[model samples]
Target: MISDTLIPDTSMTETNTDKDHIKATMKDAILKAAEKVFSDYGFEGASFRAISELCGAKRALILYHFKSKDALWKAVAEDVKTRFLTQFSAYYHEAELKTDLQKSRQLNVAFLKAARDVPEYGRIILHEGLTPNERIKWMSQELKPELVTMPDLQDPFLIEASLSGLIRHMQAGALLYLGSMGPLIAMDTEDADTLLSDASIEQFADYFQAITLARMDQLKQLEEMQKEQVEE
Candidate 1:
């Protein structure tokens, strides 16, 4: 018999524990709709009406449920936080994060695989996380103690911002590029599809990993130079 604790668990019990299942369902719908809308149009471009129209729920109901647009965005952000924890945290926990380069490469691959279907997640991340919004702040607080096993980041917050930006841009660009030109590019291709395919995705991971390792090396060199100057 397999032990339950050792098994990788992705199950959510549908019990009426904290929030009513109905309310949870409604909130999830709103948040999903908001994700699509916000992804297509940024935070400033998305509105309660747009989300409500997509959800097929009354706009007033959206307000009654979440209070306002910013509140809805906050809820969206909270949902994003939970999603990241549930989706990618396990892999990070599973990996050996001895160095930033290794961790960045591992995390990039993990996040790309986890997010292939949920491309809207990339959009949601880009919308608020381009400048370290509250969601990212919460993520920093949550992920650091767990996955960031490194002693000190190259300015932890700045590192987080850079990583997030790189992931968001690559994810969005890959989806857009492949969706438009994937067929044409892969017509006489050697192996497989362009961006959406697993091979292409892995290629992206490799590219981004190289970029991240280079950046880390540059930061280390800068730190060493500063130390030499201080000693002089």
Candidate 2:
């Protein structure tokens, strides 16, 4: 019969808990570093070595956490999706939006904040839009069904296109090509940096919401005019 108190159950539990905490920390660090690298260099351009360098972790450790680059990309995409949904859900419930347009604006605001909070999300999306694959399809499958059910998001395609296109273009102009376009836009390095600041993102979100609502109102007016003509 072995002595059960040799190491003590409490000691064993503490050791296991420490290991679990370390593993979780390392995994989180790797995911964060991978997001920055993937955003800078799309899926094809990103490398495990680059991510390891960024996180100051060994390549073997990263591989241990995530089997391969594809697996890592999938993980990051899932994280982005989760963050967006979580933020939107929280804001929707907390805000208690009354009308469809109000809900739309609130959701849009939540999305912009999520994109800003997760810097890699927009870059990853732009990359997917340029070179779509099964991953993109998977993302669409995950998001589209939920999006279509929203009262203000019934026409998911049009809303997605309009919002994504705006974000992509703004990201490219403000972040990706800032070095080149900064001078032309009369923006110094500091000014360019401000483009991605929280205040700027909020401003952009408000502008986007206003334009979207205005467009919807215009469409409604046009439809009513067409109905009048038909009745006449």
Candidate 3:
């Protein structure tokens, strides 16, 4: 009988104040604080009190939204997924057909452009992927079912693995771009093409393109061999 009423018994005069449409100010405040703190210190060095102080919230309020430091870290990981993975996955998937080494130059450039445009993306990836953490593992397993399972539908795990490695290599250079070559690259500028035109930025992108193309050729050979076996 208790299970029959899933809806709250609020009267008609009572307004529903806790709708999902309501912006979670508390959560956002805490998340923003956590991002700054975590970015500066990494997860191990970042403290709840530091985040709470940065957020201008009591420690209890921070804990109330996040439950525990681990939960907060998980939230940050999810934040990275929402911020970076959603867009990068789409762009990378769309850029797949532009596999020519020349055309992929633009994709490589675009990757750098996106990192600049979305600065948090660089920090989040470095922290979550490059660094080791259970929170990273948990969020990765929870969030990336589509990316991981995609190899099943695509039937080319090798291609995807090679691509993953290439992307990681590009992202590894992102911080350096921000620190040293940022002004010349004009990373703060909005133009993608201009920033990519710098001659010094050539090596990683060129190497990635070459390696990826070679991997593709290998995959094609494997496919042809499988077809021959089937015909035989």
lDDT of 2 at 201: 58
Kindly list the per-residue Cα lDDT of model 1 for residues 1-232, writing each as its tens digit. 1122322222565555534655666666777787678766767778777876666667887888888887877677566556754666665557777765566666666666555655555566555556745566754554333332322345553375455565455545654544335546667574344456667767887987676556667777878999999999
The TM-scores of all predictions, comma-separated, are: 0.57, 0.65, 0.57
- Report the lDDT tens digits of candidate 2 across residue range 62-137: 8899988889988887786677567656655667776655666565556555555555656776676577577778
Query: Please, what is the whole-model Cα lDDT of each candidate in the order they appear?
Result: 0.61, 0.63, 0.58
Q: Candidate 1: where are CA atoms >4 Å away?
A: 1-21, 93-101, 128-193, 212-232
Which candidate number maximizes lDDT? 2
**Candidate 2 local distance difference test against the native:** 0.63
C-alpha lDDT of residue 131 in model 3: 69
lDDT: which is higher, 1 or 2?
2
Report, for all candidates in order, the number of backbone clashes: 0, 0, 0
Give the TM-score ranking, best first: 2, 3, 1
Model 3 residue 20 CA deviation in Å: 8.9
TM-score of 1: 0.57
